[model samples]
Target chain A: MKKLMNDPERIVSSFLDGLVAANGTLIQRLEGTDVIVRRSSPPQKVGLVSGGGSGHEPAHAGYVGKGMLDAAVAGEVFTSPGADQFFAAIQAADQGEGVLLLIKNYNGDVMNGEMAQEMAEAEGIKTEMVIINDDVAVNDPDQRRGIAGTVLVQKITGALAETGASLQDAKRIAEKTVSRVRSMSVALTPCTLPAVAQPSFDLAEDEMEVGIGIHGERGMDRREVASSEKTAQLLLESVLKEIPSAAPLALLINGMGSTPLMEQHVFANDVIKQLDRDIQHTYVGDYMTSLDMAGVSLTLLAVDDELSSYLQAPVHTVQWTQC
Target chain B: MKKLMNDPERIVSSFLDGLVAANGTLIQRLEGTDVIVRRSSPPQKVGLVSGGGSGHEPAHAGYVGKGMLDAAVAGEVFTSPGADQFFAAIQAADQGEGVLLLIKNYNGDVMNGEMAQEMAEAEGIKTEMVIINDDVAVNDPDQRRGIAGTVLVQKITGALAETGASLQDAKRIAEKTVSRVRSMSVALTPCTLPAVAQPSFDLAEDEMEVGIGIHGERGMDRREVASSEKTAQLLLESVLKEIPSAAPLALLINGMGSTPLMEQHVFANDVIKQLDRDIQHTYVGDYMTSLDMAGVSLTLLAVDDELSSYLQAPVHTVQWTQC
Candidate 1:
């Protein structure tokens, strides 16, 4: 597992520096921290903040811009950020209005985000938090891990917050989005940490792990590698069965780190063909990723008028843009 | 190699179908061919057309939209499309004005593109062609392979054509861009074709291939894998030495296929630090890729004020957007 990095200890800082260097026009780093905020002047709206581990390159930072997250905190690779860093992000992102934290339902992330929210509230700043646990792969709904569906939550809530919505309204919408979306992934190969040369897990060339987690957690089942159509059917069926309604779907075909766009799009074609209902909006790319893991995830968001409009709304993020 | 595809024979068609399925709002497939054209009604401007082997996702097709390419013809994986397909692309793209073909300087592509231009001219559809040989790694300038720098050529010329430039002017600017840009790549691992079980090329755990082609063609040199900073210096030095002028530069840090964005950005950070000239533009991502190859390429386009404006102009393509 060779990496194009200088020092394993400096991977996160180098990544932040590189992102700002390439996109300084749209985003900037918070002076002495791993926090990235939009370069534009803070708008008088509810600030949206989301963050977690660092290996998912575009997940938390690539989305920091005008129409998405106001600020994103970064942790070390596959590790959660400390409470102080999240607090710093909240302070940087907040305008006159309050702040809303969109947290993925990982244990470390939730704990740190809660601690940061408490710190912000102590300083007389209004704050709210929404936990996203949309991964249907886990049978226990409360224990489900948030995966690619968190991106949809960010986009929809970010659009609402940009419209000067109140913190309560933003939290409500974020919660609704969390409840409405679900994701499931399949991994053909596991990822290795930048500091380590060994893969997180092992799989034979002819096998695949279904319902894999973004952090390289072992999936619920392993099976013989299937064709694109069958893989789509397997993931889509699991995702569809967990959705609460038959509303028009907003589909996201996300590439786990190393899968090519060619494979992602090919799988998306199969998923669209198998679904019977209307797909209001379609997003296909590496929106969220694990570190060089060769796999793909399918996220289905049941959208009505409001969610559909927000999903289609223009965004100026680096990874996921709509014009 | 385990691929997320149904059959090797159907890979190209499936890829095209998947692309159209996801981006139907912006692009559509030509009725009976593999050419992809914009979904919007044709504008009465010079049509810009480009194409090549199909393995490079988002290169020729991901660029077809309002401010980029008008049409893109697709070939099989790493195989050239026939002249007839290029002719169909020209016919579909041409409105009342003529069409300009952007050909990368591979022997098969040049021959096919030239034959297609002749065929279109015979049918009274006036056409012009520009060949891009920007890879400076090859010593013979005429024999140099066109690589990631072709994307910049497409972009600059596409923006010019969208402004209703005459076919002659579009061709002139396309040729100018071809002359101004240069590229070099480093591959840490080689990719495997969908139909074959063997890899394209092999590298020891500690080795890297420098100056590699976009296809699986071997590079000019091989060495022990170095740090991101050292890699950036090596590639930048080669690219800068060949550039003709000391004018501002537009840099593209392109991911070959499977290199993670985290690694790409880290490399971008190093490249920006080492380059001393004014970097007028910076694009970082998998713009043009070799299927599943883990590598990165650097492309530099020496830009003047005129070229910078076109480089920054808004484009609404599937893979790239500026709004």
Candidate 2:
């Protein structure tokens, strides 16, 4: 697939620069690094930091704003950032109250995030890390990868941190948020990396990849493409089986880059109709995306009063804004 | 270009139902019509309404909320909504106050909107209409089509109407807003309708359509696809030439559905770098789209003190919200 980029090597940096320029009032990029931080983080509050690969456009960076992440470190497309970059983000976000790291359950991200926490500690800053493994597609828990559910965790944890929670408190709440959320994706068409000339995977015109990874990794199963209703039912049943409780839920229908909002909504309608539960909140859009991958991911967060309130709290960011 | 829809004939209704389901707190559909209105429009305030074809996902519907549009009429995919549907929107939005229709400069939309206006008048409801022709791609004024710039006009005029401006005052400001905006688009790939087997237009692997319309219409020119920098330079130069004055600008980098946000931001960065004038606001996202066409459109709106203030006013809608 042809991309609208200049140099594939500089694509991530270019997107970050553009984002900071467009949202200069709310965010700023740390010079010489791929770390973007809130322009004015609340003083003496537990700072929130999250980072991962770059293809997820709004994932790590779009969540950096008021009432969300204090800093987001970006790596190259579909690749984790360096440990030093994560450490830089920790330093920038750390106040007197310490910092909390929300790491996705990818091997590189986990290793680098832990290394950054250590680096921050060596510099006399307190830090805590929470690993999110919300994808229920994989049968083995250890093999699960974090996906769109990370956004829900960010929203709740960021709001908790903004309320001046201690690092321990924020860490506990973030861990809870992570545990209660589950996500799975379906890819109708594979995404191509800017530097790559071919798509990540191939599918027949009538085929789809189910339980797909956000970084264009192949899914657990493949099937002939079905109607939106059937697709939503398949994803929802898989997600519901892994959910921990029958509590009120928050539904997120996330578009995989190239999926139209029209299709997302159609899929969402089918999902909502098939589900029989107390759904408190419904968000549909491209929250966490795989670059130009045409598909949708369903995220279900079992919510109680605490999680529900935080989800509804006012957040002003570039991609996800509620005011 | 396969879609995640059940029936092409029911796609519009399904999308509207899904939208209302997701954003029930903010907006609702008028019983049997494809008209979405704000949940509770302030009484005695001049109403703001906008609508067009259904493919522009957030354009007319996403703008319906507290400080923007009171109602949005949706037609089929790329087809104009019926005059009666628009009249339903007008009657529902009019809360003992006059209603203002913001019509895009399309032949069918203009005709249907005018018919709706007459129907409302016959029913003893006051109404006014403003036609927006912001696309500078067409050389002939009469042939221009309204595009993404319609979003800016909706924002400013919606805020104006909320301030209890008379219908005449609202129409005046709406016209002024329309006159100050200019937009141009470039498409890398064409979109296919859900029921159609072929794309609207075909492009060579390395070619792009310039000056493209939102309805998958053929562009005025075609050229080999270039780097993001070159593409932005071409679109920005065309837009700047048609801009009326040196007033500070509000820039909009709109993604034609299916264009990844990464590419959109990369394009936005290039556009911002090439512009030499003062820009007060920059919005980069899929504000308006042409189904799943892969492209980007740049909109430049000259803003004065009055326009700037209204543009920045707080609005609460499904697609756009500011506290």
Query: Which runs of model 1 end up more than 4 angstroms from their true locations?
Result: none
TM-score of each: 0.99, 0.99
Colliding pairs, model 1: none
* CA shift of A288, model 1, Å: 0.8
**Candidate 2 residue runs with Cα over 4 Å from true position:** none
Error of 2 at B151 (Å): 0.5
The lDDT per prediction is: 0.91, 0.92
Write one digit per residue (lDDT tens) for candidate 2, span A1-323.
Answer: 77899999999999999999899999999999999999997779888999999999888899999889999999999999999999999999999789999998999999999998899999999999999898888878888899999999999999888888899999999999988899999999999999989999899999999999998887989999999999999999899988866688999999999999999999998998888898899999999999999999999999999999999888988988887
The DockQ score of candidate 1 comes to 0.86
Q: Give the range of the ten consecutive residues with the poorest summed lDDT in model 1 chain A.
A: A38-47
TM-score of chain B of 2: 0.99
